[model samples]
Target: MPLDRRQFFQASAALGASFALPAPLLAAEKGKERRIDLVSSAFTVALDPSGASRSAVWGFNEQLPGPTLRFRRGERVHLAVKNELPQETAVHWHGLRVPNAMDGVPGVTQHPIATGGRFDYRFELRDSGTFWYHPHQASFEQVPRGLYGALIVEEEKPPSVDRDEVWVLSDMKLDNQRQPVEDFGRILDIANDGRIGNQILVNGLVAGSQRTLTIRSGERLRLRLINAASARFFRLAIDGHEARIIAFDGQGVTPHPLPAGGLALGPGMRVDLIIDCMGSPGQSFPLRDLGRPPATPTVLGALTYSSQPALRSKPLASAVTLAPNRIAEPDLAKASDHYIIFQGGMRGSPVIGLVDGKPSRIQEIMAKQGLAWTMNYNAQHEHALMHEPLLHLRTGEHVMLHMINETDFLHPMHLHGHFFRVLAVDGKPTPHREWRDTVIMGPRQSIDVAFVADNPGEWMYHCHILDHAAGGMMGTIVVE
Candidate 1:
């Protein structure tokens, strides 16, 4: 069946009478710090229409995609994470520029919280935009096993709209019994396109017309899209509607229309869209991901209008721009330039690299070390307790990172603790030159990004593809 047309993909009632997403974990009060108790453990849930099938998942507060933690900008938050899983884990606040100790890369920032242990993450929210949290220890396995959540910090006076929604988009490789397939971090998968998921999810439910966004005609919505998948890039389009992008990776940007083809959202990224629903009452439009093959999109969900009369005859005539965060702009004239050459992959050029600091071929590194990727010709494996960061800069230095991708695979590169201006891709200046904590690097492409090293710490810089991270495409950056 062709999903692009979506004639058979109406938002069904099979999921439930009202398939509502889990509400925000808790709200905040003015002049007061918000605190929450988050527990990570394995639980069972029915993932399909059949009540007989249940999936064992690891989630926070017992909710897959965890709880939506919403807070006001500048509010202090105390999140106490208790790990009930057998293995150790730590929570990383994705895209948040917090103090280094709270960044949450187990070996880099803090020690992994052992089983039956609790770690208190106390930080003050300095910026407001779409962000997320997930386990940093063995993330290649933990994230895909249902351990991630949205963390939203609202601006003091955000644009007025009918409603706000958060969608955590992810995918899982499920087995016959609807359980997660356990194959993780295989060299073959790590060196290729990473381990692609078999089942797509929106807000923890199997997507494809099961979930819906209900709206009244002429209503406006602020949709926050988070890609929590281990490795899935979404090229999305809204049928019969216009959605202007207001933010990327939690940083405000000039409202822009859909790119020439579609909006490409890679793993570990977020997009804030301002969608004015001008559809007629009782009509529905499909939100599709065209990245998958066969010229057919996978229906992520639909925007359905209710039977009530239209809220207005025309779309709201108001600005939908977001206020910018206080990120220090890079002084390019004084910024120091650095290079990071990425090499090795299943289909990449044959190159000689290091294994345990000894010279070796890429093939030998994969066959003997269970690793398949390299950053800067160094064999700094992810399983190590300590390592030399790929780049080091003095605190408060402005630096430009020129990342070269020598492999034949798309890598969504994610940098923790700081947002960089994407100056260019493939040697061409970006129109917006948007600030992002994560950006996609095309095969054999070059990207230039610049950021101010204002936050001092050892930050994890790695591929958002979890398997690739496990297979040694991961490293750390230090500023001191």
Candidate 2:
């Protein structure tokens, strides 16, 4: 339900009221479990709205992007995932604080849901923010084949807006017949910038100016943008509207206008934006992907105003700040400092990288082992039996991890089970110091992030570029 002015204020006030319900009664009501059956099977989808051709896809619940799972904060969710496809798969809740066993990396945390098998994932919603879920098993192939969806945890006191929307931004590589190309896990793609899809998609359909978001003038919208692409990055900008970012990767942050270069959403990242429809009636504003060539920016969609009169004479004056999640801040003075150097890609020095148990150079491994990238001078395959974790810390240790990217390719590194405060970018202090679960690291750049490792378990830390993880940019952090 949309939070109107009255409900918004009441909810905000309820945050301070402790005299409402008894602890046992409140726990019983809030802990009421909701279960849903999620099935992954092979289906055909016409990604092009014209229905030129249908692409064979493997998605959850017969949908390209799967069903959007909604839950209130503190609610218990039981996801009974049934695997109907021929291959094994497992769903990973991208940004939620699930138990170590429920983290969903096949073979690492729990066994993959085998073909024709079912896995029950039960967890409580500990955070209120926009999140998503996708297959962690062979993600390079599964994700592009259309197996991802939004997971929204409604805030106790959300912003008052005309409407709240979620846009799952993704891409797909297709042939002339609109069939998905089976050339996944290629060495060339893994070695360089991960494989990029030709067709950009917004919620399953092809994204273009035809994909429109209708609104009335002088209305405010809470737009949650999620990037579920394998490797694509969206540097987005609206033609005539001002978009202020309210949160990053679901965590609340100080509301602010878009940075000078617009919003850069890397793969597996999410951003919440507050867009005020100040346009005139019948006007349309194109949402362009500026990351492409400046000569011709790709219009992902358009924001068009209805023919009706303005909703109000002026924009909504309600505060856009979101309720922050429960995350422990890192004390820099006592936090242990660690460094991870990212190496190997298409172009780099003739460095030796560990492949399996043997050391191999970049050139030889791609042809023989289908590996391309390395972390800390070692390359690891997903769910590999011999792989070792990158970092190990006590259950509540404060860690200041400095990630040094040496390659010439971009990597959106994602850390599971925890949101870290981005302390610095390229050795310089960040202004907002926002918290994010997934962060983009530029070529030859260094990023310093600090967080308290309070979530005890073995967590995967890998590049969000699915191919890169299959290549070698995959590792785990152990908090015991």
Candidate 3:
């Protein structure tokens, strides 16, 4: 059964309402600094055009899709979050390499901010790219209720384009009356695919299905695509056009043409594309999800050309290369190898796992308000967010992690505070080794990633599947 609003609040409130300590006292550093005041509250949104079919959702500053926060590459951000919701909430700056204190995981990094409490987050932006922010406490509920926003870190020397736009993609489960359904924390959903929504949204509008961008022929565009959905994986393609994938997960990569099969964006992932309008005037093209059923290819958006002659008969001739961030390459020859295995999630099989250094079973965990998932044999209970580190490493150590998935589902694993190079999958070396903050692990798959632990702090490594992570598939890495 779905949890009622009061029950959801009770569960979120049980996360504890302790205040976080003040950010480190550092001199107001020089750089582009800005103060952003964000308030979390409930708002009514019109999912349909009639305005009668509205959904009550939680949002930042009473606006769905919150606000687009823009910053420069080396700016200092001082963000103050005022919680107006009925329960506690904290924001995690997804994909940003902020200090450990500003990572925003309740109990693990900081305490949850209570109702009507205000928390200040101060951090310096190191790398400029596409990132996002959302509540970390009870995210399985808060995020799905519409509490996420886009964060853009402008490049020092950005590429030239007619327009630079951000497309925040999301999904929501709705009832017959167009109201958001309340089936959060269902056991079956937690064990299987985590909360796949029925309706797809782009920038908080159902109109995304038919939204059109008018452009002149031969004009160049820069599109920043963010997958903010809780669990949905989007396989997208732009019909009648070719897009060059320049960046992934906020990290710049060697520019390459997107595959004909399209790009796959899992939860917590981002992709940057540079595309040129090639279609003739008065012609229209669609940006669609190819993974959906043939009868219904989810049309994310459209591109319509104006009645103007082409600037040049052919596409843009200039070759483009993005500036790479300053990240140390892993020394694979001297890398220390480690393994983290995923287990459980069987229908009839018993979930035998460990919770907080104690032996526990699936029934026991469920009875205590927990889900059935684990990483390295450790399952975190609902009330206890902080757990011992899975492994401790010294700074500058290059290590290889073999993430083995034994379950029957896909898990997009995300590592905070650092990006890792994907070396191999299923023991097969990759042709183009790429760096990513989040890697999708398929069923019964084994992926090997190498990274240098240069960041000095306790960072989180967990499944991007919010429900699974909340259930127990989360751990911390301590680099000293």
Candidate 4:
């Protein structure tokens, strides 16, 4: 029998509720800054309703998403990472601007911590926004296996909200047994869309048992959505509500209504939404993923109103204002213009390029690393996290990059430690003029982005596609 819409939704809810919901990991409490220990080790997590089916993976503190490390802007964080896994690993603070020596890129900033060894990461939190931490060494394998967590830096006086929530979105490839598929890098996958997973998880919860956010009618919420996926780009919408975008990629922006179509969140990107629950009491609305196919919109979670009387019938305010960060506006007049071409992938015309300063062919890259991607005709084959700076600049210099995408795929290019003002897309200027740490580039398209070289350090810039980055689509920037 064909399933109707109601039946389909009921089935989905049943599937989600069949498994035991894991206890939510609490964010570190606000207090004096002190040393925190995180252990990287192998663990088992249930990805299916059966509960018997578990995937063996590596994680921090043996938790699926580790812990949510919370801090106030300007507070010092001292973390000691203990590696219990067999191989070496290092944590990269995804969007924080820290001293180069503590940046956590193995071999770039520091050597990887060997098995049973510990490394201390001491840095001051400078930015207040949604950021993340994950293994920079062998990230293609480490991140996908589940060694990642949310790092939230709160502003001194945070916006008034009934509740604050962090949603970290991720996916995992699974086998018939509901175990994580062990294939890390297939040439075709690396050359194309990276590793598209078969199962999606929201804050470590699988399909059936994803928690619902319950709120009193007319309550305001601050939802921090982090796209922790290796490659998936989320086109998200909340049914029966409007989400005012308050921030993007850890930087506050002028509040604006989320696009009617949806908010597109690329990998490694974070979006802060101020949502007012206007629905009637006892009603439940879905947070839908419109990016997936039309077969069924992926219901990430539900926003259910409390059974109590409604507080208000309308939204709190039509416009919400947020204090911007200290990021300097890009000086477009004095910006030095540079163009970087992205080429190579599966199904595209073959092109020869340099891999680690040596001339190489597409086939050679595949043979060497099962890679199928390149950035600016350079296939990054270096095992270490460090690479020679692709662009070097003096501190505080304004730089504009024209990233031309020649590949026949979408690449969410991400720059570490700093955010850039999006100048234009495909030659047209952006109306919002928002700042972002990651920007999506479509096939055969070009994007002009400008940023001040204010953070003096060696930072990695690469495709957010983990497989593609591992395959060679990565570079570094040096600001001195």
Q: List the residue pairs that clash in candidate 4.
A: 15-208, 16-208, 16-209
Q: Considering every candidate listed, which one attains the maximal lDDT?
A: 1
TM-score of each: 0.95, 0.92, 0.89, 0.90
lDDT of 4 at 191: 81
The per-model lDDT (C-alpha) reads: 0.86, 0.85, 0.80, 0.80
- Clash counts per candidate, in order, are 0, 0, 0, 3
Off by over 4 Å in 1: 1-18, 27-31, 49-51, 292-295
Which residue pairs collide, candidate 1?
Answer: none
- Candidate 2, residues 351-431, lDDT tens digits: the string is 788767688888877777777888998887787835778999999899999999989888999999999999899889998
Best by TM-score: 1
| Model 2 residue pairs with clashes | none
Q: Which segments of candidate 4 are over 4 A away from where they belong?
A: 1-32, 48-50, 208-210, 292-295, 356-360, 382-387
Tens digits of per-residue lDDT, candidate 1, 277-367, equal 9998889888989884565689999999999898888888888888898999999999999999998888867977788778899889988
Output the worst ten-in-a-row residue range by lDDT, candidate 2. 19-28
Per-residue accuracy of model 4 over 154-208 as CA lDDT, tens digit each: 8887887877888889888888887788888777788878887878888776742
By the TM-score metric, which is better: model 1 or model 3? 1
